[model samples]
Target: MKKEFLANLAEILEVKETDITPDMKLGEKVWDSLALLAVAAAFDSIYDKVIPVKTIGKCNTVQELLDLVEEDD
Candidate 1:
């Protein structure tokens, strides 16, 4: 699930998978509202977890977003 999430995220952000890190800050130009929306959709489809966009918005880093995606997936 984590791999898939990272791959999907990399695709959404138009970056290489190796470029994304758990500790990476989401201050890049690619990390915009649209990306977050796509991430929300990906999370629901990939992990069957419907995380709120508002809740997701609170994430300041990749790890924060990853935290929202529990290991149960």
Candidate 2:
């Protein structure tokens, strides 16, 4: 799930797969908002879960986002 999430995120952000390290700060990216919305939509489509925007705002890394997705599960 984490891999899939990362792949989708990288795709949405137009970042290379190698560039999207788990430790990187998502909000520091210039394309964060669009990438985040894409991630949120992907979550809803793939997991049948809707992640709130506030929760999305609080997540800083792929691991944190994965944790939130797991918690939602």
lDDT values for all models: 0.83, 0.76
* Stretches > 4 Å off in candidate 2: none
Please report the candidate that would top lDDT against the real structure. Answer: 1
> Whole-model lDDT, candidate 2?
0.76
lDDT of 2 at 28: 60
| Clashing pairs for predicted structure model 1, backbone only | none
Question: For model 1, where is the 10-residue window of minimal lDDT?
Answer: 1-10
Candidate 1: residue 65 lDDT (0-100): 86
Residue 65 in model 2: shift from native, Å?
Answer: 0.7
Quality of model 1 by C-alpha lDDT = 0.83
What TM-score, to 2 decimals, does candidate 2 have?
Answer: 0.80
